[model samples]
Target: MDVPHPFDEAVATVKALAPAVRSESVPVDDCLGRILATEAVARIDVPPFDRAMMDGFALRVDGELEEGITFSVTGTLAAGDAPTGSPPAGSAVRIMTGAPMPADTNAVARFEWCEESTSSQHGTTAASASVRLLRSVRAGESVQPRGQDGGAGTVVLGHGVRLAGAHLSLLRTYGIAHLSVAKRPTCSIIVTGSELCRDTEALLAPGQIYGANDAYLSGALTTDGIAVTECSYVEDSRDAIRTALVKAVASSDFVILTGGVSAGDYDYVPRVIADLGGQIAVRRVLMRPGSPLVAATVEGAVVFALSGNPAAGFVQFETLVRPVLRQAMGWHDEPFPASGRLLHTVKQKPVRHTRILRGAARIEGGVVVVDTEMAQAAGQISSFASANCLVRLDEPHVEAGTVLPLRFLDGALSSR
Candidate 1:
C-alpha cells in the first residue's frame, strides 16, 4: 500500500519538531565539531613580530635578488631569543625559521645563499666570520612582517562555523583557551522488542538475537555530534513502552523508539504516544525500507518510532532523524544534495511511495555513480555498511546509466 506522508513533507515536519540546542562555553580542546556561538576575535597579532620565514640570514636590501654581495656574519638568532643587534647594510644575522628578524633588517637569505668564511654553517653559535653572498634577494625577501595573518580585533572565526583541528590551532595561537560553542542536542533511544539480547558473550537461544538497534542508534547519534543520554530496551507491552518513553521525553530533547510503530498487534508505540498526550506528527512516510516510520511530539520533545528491521531503522535514522538533529544543532541543511548515476538496472513492484535503496556511490573522472549490492533487503544489515548513500528512485524501472536522486548519509556528504 502507498504510504500517506511524502518524503519532503516528512523531512520538513521532523525539522519543525526538533528542539533548539543551547550553547555553552567550553575549553578549546573540547570544541572540535561544535558550532561556534559567537565571533572569535584575534586577541593579538599572529607571530606577533617581524619574523624569519626560513633559516636564512637577515639583512636590508633595495632591489631584486643580486649575487656576489658579501656581509660580515655577526650573530645567530634562535626562534625564541631576542636579537642581539640589528645588522647594518653591509652585514647580516643568521636567522632560524620562526625567529624574530633583527631591527632594520628587511630581508633574510637562507644559509643556502651564502658561505661562511671559517666557521662550519651548522650550529646554534654565532658565525663570527665574513660571509660571501652567492645568491641575490629582493627587499623584504623571506620576511614575514607582524600582523600578516591578522591584527588584534580581527575576526579570525565567525559564528556558526563548525570547529576543526585547524580552527583550534588558530585559537591556540591567539591564546584563546576557551570557546563558546553550541551544545549537542540530547536524545534517548528506546529499543522495544522481546527477542533482543544485549549480552554478546552469552549463547543465544532460538528466538533471541543480539541487540543491534540500541548500539547502532547510539553510535549514529554520537557520530552526528548528538548526545545520547539513555539507551534502554523494553518488552512488547504498551505500559512498558509508555513508561520508558515518558522518562525519555522528560530526560532528553528527543526519543527514538525502535520497533512497535506499525499496525501489528505487538506494535503499541503509536497508541502509547497518544495516551501520553503526544500528537502524532506523521504515521507513515512514502519511502520504502522505512514506510512504517512514525513521528510524534510531547513534553517539548519529538518521539520517533522506527521499524524493527535493522536496515529500515538505519535508513530512517540517516535520512529522517539526522537531518532534524542537524537542524536543531544549528547547522544548515544541504542546499543541493549530491546525485549518482545508476550503475545497474533496478526492478521493483510499482507503488506510490518513494523507494529508498542502499547503494555504493563513487566519483570517477568527475562523475558520480552508484550501484546496489546483493543484500539490499529491509531486514539485511550488512548492505548499509558498504553503502555511502540512499538512492531515491520513485519509479519501478530504473535503467542503468539513468541519473537518480540521492542523499549522502549523515556526515558523509561531500561535494562532487
Candidate 2:
C-alpha cells in the first residue's frame, strides 16, 4: 500500500489520540513545571493594605520647605502592628518599612532627610517628643498601596497555564498551599531484534548489532517527564514481540517499540500487535527515513513502532510520539519542526518529503541559516548524533535561500 505523507499521518494520529487522564490537585511546591487546570483567583489583595516601602516616618505631607520642621512623635508603628489612631494633625509616627500607613498619613520620608530631638534634653526630664523634616515628602512615594500587585478576585494565573518557578513563588505569596495541575503520563519502551543484544561487552556476530534504540528512546521520554516503567530487549520472534507488547500495555499508558515495523519478512511488530487484539492506526508514512513508522492501540494503550535505524527511530519519535506524550503531560504547545534556510545546496528527489542533515544555526541578517553537516540517510546515526537541527528539504531540490522547516533535537524550533 502507498504510504501517506509524513506530515499528514502524524497530524492525523496526534489529533486522534485523546487525553486518557486529567488534572489532579498537587501541592504548590510540586506544581512547578505542571499545567494549571483552573484559573487561580487572588483571595485577598496583595499587601492587604497600604504599607510602607521603606524604613521611614509616616506623616501627612503639606507644603513644608523649612530646613527643620518640628513635629511631635506620637507613637511607633512596626510591620504587623496595629495603628495607634491616625497620626494626630501636625504629629508624625515612627514607622518601619512594611508597616501599614496610619489612617490619615499619606507619605513617607527617608530617615536621612529627617532629624529628631527630645524635649527632655532641652528642659530636663520628659519623654523624647520631637522630629524635624529636613526634606519634603510626596504622597504615594515609596509606598506600596493595597491591591497594587493584584486585587482580590483577580486572576493571577489563568487556566491552561504552565507552572514555572515564578508561578510557584506567586502561589506561595498568595498563600496557596495546593493547586490543581495535570497529571504526567507514563510510558514503556520495547526494543526487539534477533540480532540486537543489550550487553555491550558481548561480541557481535556478522549480522548482529548492540541495542542502542532502547537507551535513546528511554532517555528522550524521561527528559520530557514521561516515566518509562518497563524497558526490555527481545529477540525478533512473533511470540516474543506479542508477549512484550501485552506486558508493556498492561504497565504503561503508552508503549514505544523500536524496530520490526518495516516491510521485511522478519518484521513482526505489526502482525503481532494485530493478533493480540490491537488496532493499527497507521502503518507507514510518505516521508524519507521514517516512512515505516506505525502506531497502534493494544488493549487501550497507545503503541508506537519505530524504525530499527537510530536516525529513523529518533525522527519518528519526535514527529509522532512526542506530541502525544507532551499532551498527556499537559503541554499546550505541540512540538513542530522549526523552519530555516539551508546554508548549502541539499540534493533530494521531489518524490517524497525529505529530512536533511544540519548542525547548529545562528541568525545572520534576520535569517536562520543551518549548516549542513552530512548527507541525509535513514541509517546514518552519526549525522543525527552531531546534528542539533534537522533541515527539512521538501520535494524539488531548491537553492541555498529556500526556506525549509527545521526540527531541533532539543525541542526548540526556528519560527516559520
Candidate 3:
C-alpha cells in the first residue's frame, strides 16, 4: 500500500517529541558549537575606569605654550599599577599605556611631542618638561572612558546562542569559567540482511551481496555527532530481528535499523517492532528508492527502519532522521534542503516525490550550477558515493531552468 510522505510525518513526529534532555554546566573551553541555556551578563564594566591609550604625560592643558613654560614630573605609572595620587596643578604625571589617568588631569601629551630639561622648581630638585605648541591636547583625547565597551548589568550574550571562537573570547573577558549548555542526544544503528557479509573477500553465493548500509549509516551518524554505539547485523529471521530491536532500544535514545522494513514475508522489522508494543508512525514515504521507510517508537525509544539499499537509506536519514536528531540536541532551527536552480532536465514519477541524481555544485557566471549525472538505479550504491546533493523532483518532469529544492547528501548545503 502507498504510504504518506515521510517528510510530512517527520515534521509532525519532531513537534510531538518534546525535548527530553536536560541542561548542564560545562567549562567554556569545551562549549564550542554547544547551545547556551542562559544569557551571559557582564559581571563588571569592561575597562572599569578611565585609562590611557598610550605612553604619555597626564597634565591639565591651560593654553598653547612656547618652549619657555615648565612643569615638574610628580611620579611614574605603568600598566596594571595604580597612579601616584592626582597630579597637582601646573605639574604632569608620567604614565604608560593602560595606566589609569590621575583624577583632575584633563589630557595627555605624547612623550615624542615634548622636550625634557632639568631645573630647580620651588627649591626642590625636579626635571622641567615643555612642549612646543604643535597641537592642543583636548580633554579625554585618546583615552578609553569607563564602560566604553561594556557596562555592568549589560547582557553580552543571549540565550540559545551557538558558541563560536569570538564568543568564547568574550566569555573569558567577562571571567566566565563555566556556562550552562544543553545536553547532546545519542543514537544507535542496526544493520540487517542475510546476504550481507562483512568481508568482501568472502565471496557471495548466487543470491548474496556485500553489505554497504552499515558503513554508510554509521559514517553519516558520526558526522552529526550522534554516537552509534551499537552496530549489529541480523539475518531475515523473526527471532534475530526481535532480539536486535530489544537490545538496541534499551541502550540508545534512537534506534536506526537498515533493511527488513519492506512488505515481503522475510522483512521482519515491522512485525518485530509491533510485537514489542511499538506503534508505526509512518510505514512508507512517497519518495522513490526510500518508499519503504518506517518510523516507530519502541518502549519510548524512537526507531527508524530504512531500506537495505545504501542510497535509499542514506537519503532517508538525511531528510527525516537528521532534523529530529538536531532538535533532540536542542538546536533551534530545522535542518532542511537548500533551494537551487537545475542545470539540466530530469524526469520523475507524476504521483510520487523523486530525488534526481546530481554530482557537485559549482559557481559559473556568478550563479550556482548543479551538475546532473546519469540516471542512478535505486539499488546502486556507487552513484551515491560521489553524489553531494539530491535535486528534489516535486513534479513528474522538470526543465533546465526549473527552480527546485536541493537536499544535500551531507549537512553541507543546509547552511545555504
Candidate 4:
C-alpha cells in the first residue's frame, strides 16, 4: 500500500498545478472584490491641488498670527472654484471645505475662530467686510497639501491586491475609470451518492438523506466571487459520475466532487478520472476527517475529490481548495497562520496524521487562547456554527498551554 501524501505536500502540489494568472479589463465600478493583475499606477495626483481642509478663512500671513489681528475680507471661495487672484497681505478669503486655496495664501483659520464684522451706513450693510482673529494661525494650518492622498505616477495599489470598497474609492480619487484585474475563475461541483436527495421539502425514501454538499460548495465558491458554471447531484454509478465529470471539465477551470474517493465498493470517482485519461496528482492526504482527498488533472481542468461527510468536505475545501483557487485568480499573499495557546490538554489515539478540528479563537488579556471543545466528528457540521477557526493538531497527545496554529474562517482575518 502506498503512503498517503503529507498534508503540506498535497497542498503544495495543488498550488503548483494552479492555472497561470490571466487578466481582463474591467470598469472601476465593477472591480470590487476582484484581484488586481498588475500594479495600479496613478495617472493624476489625488486632490490634484492644495485645498481647504475645513470651512474657514484662507489667510496670507507674513509671520506668526496673534490673537486680535484684523484682516480685510477680499473674496469668498467655495469648492470647485479656481483661484482667480491672490489675496494681498493682511487680507483673507472666506473658504469652504475642499475649496482650492487662493494664490499666496498659506493658512486657513476656521470660521469659528474668527469674528466677522461689517460696518453699517444708516442701518444698511457696507461693501467691505473684515474679520478679527480669535486665535493664532500659521502656515500649513488647516491646509490639505496637493497629492496628500497619492502622487501622480505612484503605484497606489500593488499587484495581487484584492480590491475592496475603499480601494475602489481611492482609485476613483485618482480618476481611474478602468482597472486591470485577474480573470475570474469558473467552477463546477459534483456531489455523488446514491442515497443523496436534493429536495428536503419532499419525503425521502429509505436510506436517503437531503444533500448539503452541493449547497455548501456552491455557496462557498459563489461567496468568494468564483462563478459556479454547473452543479450536479449524481447517484453512485460509474456511468453517471463519468458523464458529470466530462461535462464539468469541458466548461470549468476546475471541478469539485464530494464523495466517492475513499475505498468503498461504490467509490468510482478516482477510477473514472483514470478512465478519462486524467492523471492523479495526489491520491490521499495525511489529515484527519479529510484523509481521502484526491487531486487530479483532466483536460486542462483540475479535479478535487473530497469525502461526502459535510465537516470533512468543509475542512478540505478551506484548507486546500480555496488557496489554489485564490492563486489561479492572482492572489499571492497567503494569510499567515494565527498562533495561539491551547487552553486545555487534548488526548487522542496515537496517530501521525494531522488532526484539523473546528475551534474558537479569542484574545484574552493580550494573549491568544484557542478552545477545541466542540464535537470533532467527520460527519458532523453542527460544530461549525460557532467555530471561528480550524485548529491544527499534529500529535495525538497534546499538552495544555502549547501554542497551536490556527486558520481563520468566515472572514475572521479582517477583524483579527
Candidate 5:
C-alpha cells in the first residue's frame, strides 16, 4: 500500500496502531506531565461547603444594610471547622478564608472595614467583643457559596488533558487521591557512524567527531515524558547496525537510529532495517534539511531513521518525531501551527518541501516576532544553540517583514 505524506502518514500510523496507552491508576502526585486518560469528576463540591472568602465577620443580611451597625460576635470559625448554626440575631461569625461560612450568612465584612473591640480580631476570641461595620453590604456579598467552582460529579479534568501542577491542586482540593493516566511508552535510540565517538573528554582521531545526535534525541524524548531505556552507539558496519536495531526493538516501544537513512555510500540504516523484518513506512519527507528522513514499522512498534547530519536530524525531530511521540502518548494536540511575525529578513531558493530555520521568538507590543538572520546554515550548532524557535517557510524566499507561524522550542513564545 502507498503511504501518505510523511507528516500526515506518520501521525496516522501512530493513531491506527495499538489503542491509546493503557490507563494506569496512580497516585495523583506521580502523574505529573502524564496524559490523562479519563475525566476527573469531582466526588463532592470543590469546597464541599459555603466557605468564607476572607478573614472577617459573616453576617446574614436579608436586604442591603442601609447604614453601618455594630454587631455582637457570636463565635469564630476556622478553616477546618464545620458550619455552626445560624448566627444569633444581631450577631456575626468571624470567619477566615477557607473557613466555612456560618449558616444563613450572606456576606463577610473584611477586617479592613470592621472595627472590633480588643487589640486583635481573633476568630477564637470570646463573644464579649463587638465588630463595628464601616460599610453596608448586600445579600450574598463577600460570601463564597457551595459549588462555586463546580458541583458534585462535575468534570474538573477532561479526557486527554495533559496534567500539570495547577490541575493537580484542583484535583487534590476534591480529595482525589488517584488518577487514571496514560501509560508511558518506552523508547531507545541508536547512533550509527564510524566517525562518531561517545567520550567527549578523550582526544579525537583525525576522522573522529563527537556524536551529538544521541544527546539531542534523548533530551527531546525526556522533555516529552517518554522514558528512554537504552541509548547505544554503533559503527557504520552492517553487522553492528543490525545488532543494535534488533536489540533496541526487542525492548522499546519505539526505536530511533540517527544516520544511515540517506543514499550516501556509508548510509546503511534503511537496508539494515528492511533486512531485520521491518517495513520502511516513509523514505522521504516534504521538508527541507530533513528530506531524507525515514520512518518504518516493525513487529508493532515504530522506528524513525533520521539523516546522519546534525542539523538535518534536529529539524526532523522538531517537525515530525515530536508530534508522533506525543500522539503515541495519547495526546492529540497538534504542535506545528503556532505563528509569529518575522523580525528580520531570510532568503532561500524555492524547494519541493517546507523549510525550518532556527531563530528566537520575542513578543513585541502584542504579537510574536521571530528573528532568523543567524540560522542560514544547517551544520552550524551555534544557530540551534541560540535559537528559541524555528520558522517554517514553504515559500522560495521569505522577506524580512512577513508574518509566519513558528515552532517554539525554548518556551520563548509561551507568554505571547
Candidate 6:
C-alpha cells in the first residue's frame, strides 16, 4: 500500500480535477437554485412608468400641502390602464394600486386621508366628484417613481448567485424571461459489495446488510441540483466492477463508488479503475473514518471511491465530493468553519490522522456549543439522528469547554 497523502492535499487534488463549468440558457421559471453564469441586467426600467404605490387619488401639486384642498375627480384608473390626458388644473384621477401615474400628476393622497363628495346640487356628479384632503399631503407620497425598483442597464443580480424564489420575482419584474445558468453536473453511483442487498422490501439474509450508501448519496446529490444519471449495484468481482465502471464513466461526468478501495482481497475498484485507463490522482488521505478515499479521472469523468462504512462515506461526501461538485457548478466560495465550544469531554485515543466526529451544535448565549456524545463508529449511522455538524479535532482527547472548529453539515448555519 502507498503512503497516504495529507488530508488537505488530497482534498485540493480532487477539487483541482473538477470539470470546467458550462452554461446554458434556461427559462427563469425553472432556474430556482441554479447558479447564474452571467449577470442579470435589467433590459428596461422596472415600473416602466411612474406608478401608484397605493389606492389613492393622483393630483398635480405645485407647492406647499394645504389642508381641506378640494379637487374635481376627472376619471378613474386601474392597473394596466393607459394614461389619458392629464386632468385640468384643480382636477385629480382616482387610481388603484399599481396604476400608472398620469404624466402631469406629482402627488397622491391616500383614500384614508381624503373625503369624497358627489352632491349634484354642487354641480358635481358621481362621474365628476369632488375630493377634499382631510390632512396635509406631501409631494410624491404613495407614488412609485419610474425605475424606483431598478433602472435600465442596472445589474439586478450578479453572476454566480444561486437563484431563489425571491430572485425569480425580481428577474420577472425586469422583464427577464430567461437566464444563463451553470449546467448541473451529471453523476453516477456504483455500490460494490457481495454482502450488500439493494432491495429495501426484501428481508436481509444472514451475514448480509441492506445497502444504504446508494440512497443516501443519490438523495444528497439530487437535493443539490445534480443530475444522477444511473445507480448501479455490483458484487466485489473484478469483472462486475469493471463493467459498471466502464458504463458509468462513459455516461456521467462524475462517478462515485462506495467500498473496494482499500487493500483487501475483494477490493478491486482501484485496480479496475487503473486497468480502464484511469489516472489516479489521490490514493488515500490522512483522515479518520474516510482515510481510504481515492480519486481518479477516466475518460474525462472524475471518479471517487469512498469507504463502504456508512459514517465514513457520509463524511467524505460532505467534506470532499460536495466541494468539487459545487466548484464544477461555478460556485467558488467554500463553507467556513464555525468556532464551537465543546459541551462535554470527548474521550478517544489520539492517532496521527485527523479525526472528524459527528456532533450536535446549538447556540447558547450567542456562542456555538457542540455535543459529541453520539456513536462515532465508522459503520454506525445512528449519529445522523441529531448530528448537524462535523467537529474537527487534532488532539487525542478534548475537555469540556474547549473551543474547536466545527463545519455545519448543510453548509449553512442552522443551530438548534
- Candidate 2 runs further than 4 Å off: 62-68, 75-85, 117-129, 201-206, 354-356, 365-367, 411-416
Off by over 4 Å in 4: 120-128, 333-336, 413-416
TM-score of every prediction relative to native: 0.90, 0.88, 0.82, 0.94, 0.89, 0.94
Prediction 2 TM-score vs. true: 0.88
Cα lDDT of model 2 overall? 0.77
Query: Which 10-residue window of candidate 1 scores lowest in summed lDDT?
Result: 407-416
Model 4: lDDT to the true structure = 0.88
Tens digit of per-residue lDDT, candidate 6, span 1-416: 77788777777888899999999999999999999999998989988999999998999877647879899888889999999887898889999999999979978899998999774553453553889999988888888899988899999999999988999999998999999999999999999999999998999999899999998999989988999999989999999999999999999999999999899999999999999989999998888889998899999999999999989989888888888998999887442347699999887786888888999888888888988988898878987978989988878888999999877876544555
**Order by lDDT, highest first:** 6, 4, 1, 5, 2, 3
Query: How accurate locally, in lDDT, is each candidate?
Result: 0.83, 0.77, 0.74, 0.88, 0.81, 0.89
Q: Cα RMSD (Å) per model?
A: 3.1, 3.9, 4.9, 2.6, 3.3, 2.5
Pairs clashing in candidate 6?
none
**Residue 38 in model 5: lDDT:** 88
Q: lDDT tens digits, residues 348-414, model 4?
A: 9988688897888887777878889999988779989989888888899889899988888864532
Residue 79 of model 5, lDDT score: 88
Which candidate, 1 or 4, has the higher TM-score? 4
Off by over 4 Å in 5: 1-19, 68-70, 111-134, 333-335, 414-416
Q: Report clash pairs, candidate 1.
A: 56-110, 65-136, 65-137, 66-136
State the displacement of the C-alpha of residue 251, model 6, in Å, after optimal TM-score superposition: 0.4
lDDT of 4 at 328: 92
lDDT of 5: 0.81
